[model samples]
Target: MGSMEEPSPETNYTKPLGIRFIEYIKRSNISYKTHQVIVLIVTFIAYASYHAARKTTSVVKSTLDPASDEVSLNSLPWRRRPFSWILGDGWAPFDGSDGTVLLGEIDVAFLAVYAIGMYFSGHLGDRINLRIFLTIGMVGTGVFTSLFGIGYWGSIHSFYYYLAVQMLAGLFQSTGWPSVVAVVGNWFGKKKRGLIMGIWNAHTSVGNITGSLVASALLQYGWGWSFVVPGLMIATIGLVVFLFLPVTPESVGVSEEDESDSPKKSGAEVTSPLLISSRAEVKDQPVGFIEAWKIPGVAPFALCLFFSKLVAYTFLYWLPFYISHTAIDGQYLSDAAAGNLSTLFDVGGVLGGILAGHISDRLDARAITAASFMYCAIPALFFYRSYGSISLTANVILMFITGMFVNGPYALITTAVSADLGTHSSLRGNSRALATVTAIIDGTGSVGAAIGPLLTGYISAKSWSAVFTMLMGAALIAGLLLTRLVVAEVTAKIEESRSRRGSTSRSQPAVIDV
Candidate 1:
């Protein structure tokens, strides 16, 4: 028998359908700048759909376990103790005396699994076709998200069923951040990453607002539609992603290395040997999980994000419920109104993310910028808690400010900071570590995201004030975690200023020269 020969370097192999489409686009003369724009828009929409699906559960929470007469009965002047408790009228399993605790457990179960899946997802993202990975995640997320809502139409109230669906949804949702960030990082360099990512990060707030509005509006039809609509929307968007997303520049035969050095933004250059060697090296020696964590600034940023996400996710999950239950002008709001009003918080978050990104870019200090935002969030939280209930105007104003401070660091860390660390000079231009680093940081933060809502569920039953206290404590610690990094940034700035001054003085003509 004749021995089989290995494929030659010049031999053409069967490419995936997505890659073939990308190659077709390349041959049709699309420019590099156009491809970059496509990358940004596709990723932005893709991740936004993920957030949109996640937001449905929070909006529908009120309908699931509504406030009972116990709340109104305790509101009377004659009552000794104001009994703010969940009564048995809610859906089974969640309506029992331990209903609130049970609800919190669902959040814990979903996030715990999400956190664990994140680690593995990141590892897999590095090795697989990101386009396929992301599409599977989005489609799976839609299926599971819809299943949770189907329970309503089916008249199913088993706690375990809903819990299982949510947990599975989280596992799929875990595929989003690492994949999107890694793809975006591959396209854009660090030149203006903070501002670019900041603007792009607005997708999160936009998705939340869209989800809240959609879900709240559909509540009149049925709470089931609230979840089902967003679920369908994401599934549809997933199809778009599968068709259009270019996972990396190379996937379409565009060399990012050549683009980086090219004077014009044309795609006429062939693949350079340096680019090929770099890719080969990365494929052979991908960064390990432990090694990614060991990158300078990774640990501090990861720890800071832990506390940052705790505060952010707590508000994401419970702010609507808190607003509905708390009296504004001695009147209670309907669940729909509360959900609609909650969009203001996300509106503020959009501005905060943009501002944080611009400031970090201008200052060239990611750590200091993020730490400052976390510090400011402390006062914002206190003010919102103290004065937010006075009037509708006050509530909107204070909640907006609170959201700005709270989400600024979160946006900065998850985007610009994560990208910066992922491509640290220490990596020596091997870009394989980007996904792994992103995963570890976000995965650690997901643990805090899990803890926050879980604690808020139990603490809110006792006192809302205690929940604020916990958030404030988390903010303070988040800022403190970045102290060393902030100092380093400050020192680097001072040295740079001195060096510029010395160069200016030397360059000036001497007045005493003949």
Candidate 2:
């Protein structure tokens, strides 16, 4: 259990019937271990579905707007298309001269709505039944996602139709992150949270890889199937989430510690946290957006994520398009091959998330670990850009390394850092701000995510070198944003070391001879 105690009246009243039935069947309350397992499994499925649906658009983007890239390829003359197979001639509206710009518009529109919605979603998530809130989001996301693909079947080509559908899906997508993170934060304590969330955060890259493979596999049938399949997946997982997710221990009448104690244990107060604040209070009222931002370490991390997500999402939305356009060893890959190959980037992201989390836990310095990974990404990006065209093997190796560096900081910040700040001691162990703080940090970052792909849409059209240069710059700025926090963590570590040395010398019995 977290520092949060006594289920809010809203949560208590809204407890799902599923948990009740399970407990009834068992003839006892579910144990803590059982709760943890359920939370991990359900949330993983839930968010993974969200990503799977989101990723469909990227895999299908080249198919929809291939002309712009084709023009550039012709201009280059060196890149060859020996292994490539043509999809369709590109869809209308997007197939026009302004196609790339239109695609960018819809992408930004979707993410813009998602970014704006994240703030309110976090605010509401704290006050309502997370299970229901998340379910509605999932269902809505599925509807809009399928609707976008339905354009292909329905012969709908109006730009506004696709824009509106994507924007709506983005709104629903916004709900997944805050709700899932809050649920996980509710169930687990801070002990080795990096390692735990690191393994857990693999859901992101996993979802991306799944979506890439599925979408690529389905392209031969039609691009519409790519979106439709992922749409259904998230909705199904959403049902699983509604049935099994426990928002908090109090909701299910489990012992606060989940240690087979009474429900009235009061969850043992949290006194070990290093920071404290005058702003902390005991009320169950949700934290205001402004109040949540006031928490220490929240602002810097949020700003850093702005740039970090900029880099990661740039790759997320454009990597496949980039791969298809850029020739490897005088050869181009087909849409399907490009889509499948992009999964390798996400495969590397999985390792990055785990490695970042594990490294942060060992060092006990989130900022240091995150900033270091970001700095490393600069070289990775440079190497990938310069050498990736030489051979397929070089492209794969550099892309994997680049993905690891770019996603490592992004994954750590979103999962562990957001969770840590939400429950920071500065809040006097108040868990109410968990969702709100998460919203602010991720919302700000989503703004950057929206911007990155949008800019890439234009910049890449002129010169991909310009786009890579832009990504490298964002990485540098992202790392620089953490300068203050990294310094503080380092200073604390040095002081702690000196204190331990002093304590050791004082405790020595041989001091009597001196």
Candidate 3:
């Protein structure tokens, strides 16, 4: 009571306005937990959209009745200049040789263009406005996805037209990962990111399941409808992201992690909606391409991702065909049944990813978790080769296990570890380079993605055993590469701690939130 009369002038002057606001939150128990949930949901939608668009091609091929498949290039009624000359100016062509070739090219053409576009799309996302870029990308992807279905409705038979659609569709698909990874990286920190991102990224597997279910349902009625469902779904989700998806947390007034500890409003602080343009504008130092590549652990990590993706994509493209055509002394699954069964792979993949994430989070060793799972997958791949001859049930079980192990590492290394390396403390606390860093890794991975399916197609055309051997080699190589990254990370942490303590035994610096 005596001291109240002399209320300290200095106490009022030094008290922070920001601290009071923070205290207000605690007193009311206000939390961003709701916002985090919304972010995850939207992110899931975006990833699902990507898979829906990607999986339509598989469905279309699956439902094709080999009995009804006829070559009609020459007999087509168009009577175009090329057709007239080839058919002796009056007689329609006798055989449909050109038709099959054109059809074959259409699918592979899409894959070729997709690999090329992935390399450059990340740069576009970083340089342009995210909302506009993502919106346009979604629209383009959806339109092209629908076009394939529309072609069937229109009775379109020109192979060239489908090739064009596939190429354009592939181009649009490139927009997904670069943009999604950039936004997600901005939302989270390196702390427990492996676990968090692992769970979050399971949308990849979920999308695969959703797409398979939708595709299988439609294939029984009309294969064309398969493409339309996914296309419309993507368009619908695009609208939601346009209306509600925040570019970054800062866009909503929450301070980014880098700024959470500092009260002063430094120009260097990253703000949100975590959009790439905003990131570029606010970062203290923008990393160059050369600098990003030169980072100690980045190259090895990128190589690991490349090889892992190679195996994953190979399975994605070829598994249904294998089950339908080569299963157990040619006792094959019907087209619809095969498509439905492969969905189980993604089901297992989702569980595997979540488990891997949680384990890595507790141990704080993404490399070890990734490597261990891949190594475990080797036996399952061998199991498929052995029991694949025994019974359909055994084959399905083995394939599901293979999917779980392979996809776990694929999701973890690409999302969680990429973010960690991208925002490593060596960057002078700038997290703005996430898009570029992720692009470099995934873009390099696209090379392997391009190679894997083509190699599998050719190898399976020869002997399925060769395909198994190739996948095994890829998994082993990926594990070795990640082992290198684990060593580098540990060494870097030791060096950093040493730098904080003086030669005379001073206290070590406190570890920052990852």
Candidate 4:
């Protein structure tokens, strides 16, 4: 009765859902841990949003006619049949110099920039604010992505217009992985990293699935709208990331003293003057960028990623076109039907990513997981080509399996592998090197991402048979690169044992697999 007029706890509960959530979070386990987990989930959604934006363009290609250089509404393939996609009137089914070429150019533009940008993006994330950097990237990507759709609505028939947008989007999009990988590497420890990264990687599949569904829905209105809708969605999610993403565990409440004690970093340095309550103490101050050539196995990893992406993206950028080419009863189907059927690959792709991540987590052998996918892709691609000729049903089944194996490595490498390398023990026990490591891996992969479509585009221009062969070859090459990783692992283990027995001493530390 003599207490001052203080508001009751119930009075504070009137805040909005998000505020309430924040407050509720504050009361739970150290805010630092809960905040990061929450932020991570949102970041995952943001990544998914990027895919949603990306998928829209591919799905709508079935309706748009870029081949004839016509954005004319009258020329739009509105008939809504199984496979009547016009792809901007670039080329007829299986015709050289058609949509395949144009799609390839678009892919090359994006991949080239993405690969190059990723190198710098990772280094930059280490020095700059990761959350801010990621936000900017997401926003820029959203703008360019949305512009692709708006161009169609404005009767912009210029293929270059779309190509420009692809380049910009690709550049900005590369920022996401490095930043996320760096942050995640900081949040989690070496223990169970493979499994955690694997589960986290499922976001890729989820994003692809969401992108497909959203794009398909918007394509019903018009192909351009598909781009516009997903673009807006990505932009919105990016804004959310900017607001909610926690850069490190310290922000919410994880004591730096505790984290500093972990083997990844040093406990004695927890109270260093460089440390702060509000910010993360990046392990290596003023980190220098390492050229791809300097990192051991980086070159091979890049080559591997390139080939893997070549096959993976060939499925991503051209599956609709491939499906459109499928002969039904020895007759070519329409574009709409073909485009719809191609989505089965994406559907299966989701499962493949999740399954691959789960399995790799258990095996703890990243090399074998990727190599297995590479090997499986060979037979799957063979059956895909042969079965497509037999019946549409066969084509659908084969495409799904093909996509599953093709994309499995894609998820493994980009997510799990990057995390593994970024957290590799060779960093002189510096976790801050994560951004640099991520950049190196992704930058190398970008080479493959760029080449995959260009190769497919060239092959499609020559013969569809050639395209399948190229994809198969890329898969084989990727598998071979992973073989090198396995070899390196064995070599390192032997070195470790010899050093313990004083048989051999290593001056240059070995890159420990996390």
Off by over 4 Å in 2: 1-15, 62-92, 152-154, 213-225, 256-283, 327-336
- Clashes within 3 Å, all models in order: 0, 0, 7, 30
Best candidate, TM-score: 2
Write one digit per residue (lDDT tens) for candidate 3, span 231-341.
Answer: 888877777666655555554444443335553445565544557565555563556677777766678778987888898877776665566666674576664466466
User: Which stretch of 10 consecutive residues in model 3 shows the poorest summed lDDT?
Assistant: 70-79
Report the error of model 3 at residue 340, Å. 3.3
Per-residue lDDT over 1-514 for candidate 4, one digit per residue giving the tens place of the 0 to 100 score: 4323333454333222453455555553333455557756976787778667666655554355343212111112223422345333322321234664565456567778888989888888877878778889888988998898787658676677778888899889888888887777677665566556656766766787787778766654566667777888888887787666766654443444443455335533345444442233345453467532355655666678878877876676566656555576688766556656766886677667767777776665677777888899999999888776787778878888988898877777777677666655555445556677778777877687666666665577678888888888878888987787877666766777787777444555688899
TM-score of each: 0.85, 0.86, 0.76, 0.75
Question: Which regions in candidate 1 have their CA more than 4 angstroms from the true location?
Answer: 1-27, 66-100, 152-157, 216-224, 255-279, 325-336, 511-514
Candidate 2's displacement at residue 291, Å, is 1.1
> What Cα-based lDDT does every candidate model obtain?
0.81, 0.83, 0.68, 0.68
Residue 332 lDDT in model 2?
87
Candidate 1 C-alpha lDDT tens digits along 1-514: 2333232333213223554465555554344676689889988998989988987875565456554222321111111211224212356665566655566667678789999999888888887878889999999999999999898789898999999999999999999999999989888888789899999999887786677678867766777888899999988888887887777666665555454756435556667889878777865467888899889999999999999999998888777778888898778777557767877887888889889999999999999999999999999999999989899999999999989999988998999888888889898877777788899999999999988877886798899999999999999999999999999999999999999999999999989857
RMSD of each: 6.7, 5.5, 10.7, 8.6
Candidates 2 and 4 compared: the better one by TM-score is: 2
